[model samples]
Target: MNHNIIFQKIETVDLADVAAIEQQCYPNPWPIKTMQDCLDADYQCLKGLTELSPEIRCYAFMMIGHEEAHLLKITVHPAHRKKGLAQAMLHRLTLIARINHARKIWLEVRTSNDEAIRFYRRAGFEIKGKRRNYYRYKDHNGKQIKEDALVMCYSLI
Candidate 1:
């Protein structure tokens, strides 16, 4: 984690910046509305900013249920890749989950996203199962595609 990075609870005013990073990080990004809905539902949403600057460089969303927490989304800006920003946000999320009494933290990653899988593993998450056709998106050619999601978990207990 970078010493200069700070994690802040995401607010409505931060959506545009987080959305921009989302658009840049994934093939299909969540709309600002979806993020708003998560907040409205009392999910934990956060944005990462540089201590010296207010720019949002990364963001994450997590939903906590009885004895578990699910990481709905976590993203780092492309330009900030390899700088430990993602890990910083992830660590913060893990702490929040633990504080909330989650026995484990779960996340689904696209099977093809080896980079993300590796990162999760390094952060103590284990591959638990596969969710078939969990993600549906249109490719660049406008053809709908379904991708399997690798369910991963990090146990706190």
Candidate 2:
């Protein structure tokens, strides 16, 4: 773990750079307005964790309700991936969730993303179920398509 990295609540002003990182990380990402809306709606957790001299290299958005937390999105910049950033952020979020009385944290990942599925498993998330046609995107030829999503959850209580 990098001692220099710091986690802070995300702000609307950080959305542009956050959007750029999102574009780099995902095939399809939530729009900037969507992120802003998360903040405006008082999502349970919206944090940006900085790395390597205070740049916002990683971020996450989560919503906690009725003793459960839903991780809307979590991302690490390409240049910053793998160096314990994701795990560290996950730790932070889990702590926050537990502190807020959340018994578990949940998220949906694209089934096609094997690496992410493995990573989540490594981080103690268990595959709970699958959602058919959970994600939609255009293929390289520009044909629209849908992808299944794997539901995963991590116990916090």
Candidate 3:
């Protein structure tokens, strides 16, 4: 982890950079409209940028409600993997949630995504439940395939 890396609120100015990272990180990345919706929504969104380049390296979208928050998404650029950017983002989200009076944080990840599961577990998130057929995607044959999702939660209490 580079302790000196800079993290900033996801402002409108950083959309293009954020979208680029999002596309690089996910198989089915959110569209520009979805990113815009997240920015316009009542959630707290953030971006992690390198100190030298000041380009978006990672981003997180979280919706805060009364004493709880749902971590909608967190993505790190493929080039920035294994550098603790995700951990830093999660840590920052915990702090932000605590400051916003959130007692717990929750999120869902694809069950087949072992790397992400390990990452969340290392960050203190525990498996809470499973969401069946949570991810639906069309295959090369144009048939929809359903994938399971693991629901994880972390207590900020």
lDDT of each: 0.90, 0.84, 0.86
> Would you list the clashing residue pairs of candidate 2?
none
In terms of lDDT, the best-performing candidate is 1
* TM-scores vs. true structure, each candidate: 0.96, 0.92, 0.92
Residue 22 of candidate 3: its Cα lDDT? Answer: 66
- Candidate 2 positional error at 148, Å: 0.2
Q: Mark the regions of model 3 whose C-alpha exceeds 4 Å error after superposition.
A: 139-143
- Model 1: per-residue Cα lDDT at residue 126: 96
**Residues 90-145, model 1: lDDT tens digits:** 88888899899999999999999999999999999999999999999987789999
In model 3, state the lDDT of residue 130: 99
Report how far off residue 135 is in candidate 2 (Å).
Answer: 0.4
Report the alpha-carbon TM-score of model 1 versus the true structure.
Answer: 0.96
Candidate 2, 87: how far from true, in Å? 0.5
lDDT (tens digit, per residue) of candidate 3 on 98-149? 9999999999999988899999999999999999999887755678788999
Candidate 1: lDDT over CA atoms? 0.90
